[model samples]
Target: MEAKEKVYLAGGMESDWHEKLKQRFHNKFLFYNPKDHQLDASEQYTLWDLHHIKKSDIVFAYLEKDNPSGYGLTLEVGYAKALNKTIILVDEKSDTNNEFKARFAIVKNSASAVFDNLEEGIKFLERFSIYVG
Candidate 1:
């Protein structure tokens, strides 16, 4: 049997987007969800996120205007980049110049590629055989 890729979903859990991604990619990837764990503070969440990122084959990050200023997600992107992990960034927000500038740094330096939507990102991963039958 082929083993599913380990995809670390890095983004804001405050919205339902994380759950949507989980449901969409359930069969193709084994996800390490921070929402599933009990994380109380930055320190705890940081440790948990880093641990999983280290084990993951890819880091799929979703960033939006409403969920902007994601310190944890930013940190995860940097860490994943440093570790040479494949990073697929889904930027669903950034309508203003400031937002675009803020996201530009991470997108340029950390992301392997960027997408306007989650479906596009998923399609990009298909080349790696990450889509389910």
Candidate 2:
């Protein structure tokens, strides 16, 4: 049997969508939630974040505007990109701004990109799996 891929969830920390990703990808991939850990030092935590990104085979990001967590998600996306990790971007209500479009254009061009729904995103990721077991 082929091994399941490990996907890192990069998104708003307090958002409820994390659970949805967990439920949908549970069978095909192992999802890592970086916010679950609490480290004492800021630098140490940053290192941990990078470690998690490095360990992941792919990254699934949820982007939302006016979200305080957007900055962190953006950083994670950039980090994953630098590591050459496969990325999947989900943005349901994206603003029609040039900057937002430009920033995510590369990801949209290369990896699977989904908008407006969780089911579509889940279906998109399913294509990457060669086998369930």
Candidate 3:
């Protein structure tokens, strides 16, 4: 049997998006969830994130105006891009100003695919899993 693709989940910690993503992609992908790891105020958290990003086939990130966006998320996205992993970025940019200037170029261009809605991105990933798996 073919191995399931690994997805490094990176995004806002405030939301339950991780659970939602897992529910949707459970059969098709395996996830490296940061929440399952014990990440305190230490360098080990960053190390773990980088390690998982390196190991993943896809980097799924979610960013919105309501949720707190941080440099850590930007770092993960850029690293995924550098590694040439399939990047699926869900950007809910409702503002006319477009606040996310450099979420590592994710708002405009960095990701392999960008979506306005989370469900849309999930659908794309489902199809992607079918083709790539």
Reference-based TM-score of each model: 0.85, 0.77, 0.86
Clashes of 1: 0
Candidate 3 local lDDT, 1-133, one digit each (tens): 5788999988877778899989877788999998778789659999999999999999887776565555666788889989999999877743423445533354348788988788888888787678444
| Runs with alpha carbons beyond 4 Å of true place in candidate 3 | 94-97, 101-107, 131-133
Residue-level lDDT of model 2, residues 23-113, one tens digit each, is: 7667878877876776768788778877898999888887755454356666777888888898888764355456766665655555446
Candidate 1 deviant stretches above 4 angstroms:
99-103, 130-133
Cα error, candidate 1, residue 128 (Å): 3.2
| Each model's total of backbone clashes | 0, 0, 0
Which residue ranges in model 2 land beyond 4 Å of their true spot? Answer: 96-116
Error of 2 at 67 (Å): 1.5
Question: Cα lDDT of all candidates, in order?
Answer: 0.79, 0.73, 0.79
47-127 per-residue lDDT for model 1 (tens digits) = 888999999999988876567566667888889999999999877665445656675675546799988777798788666
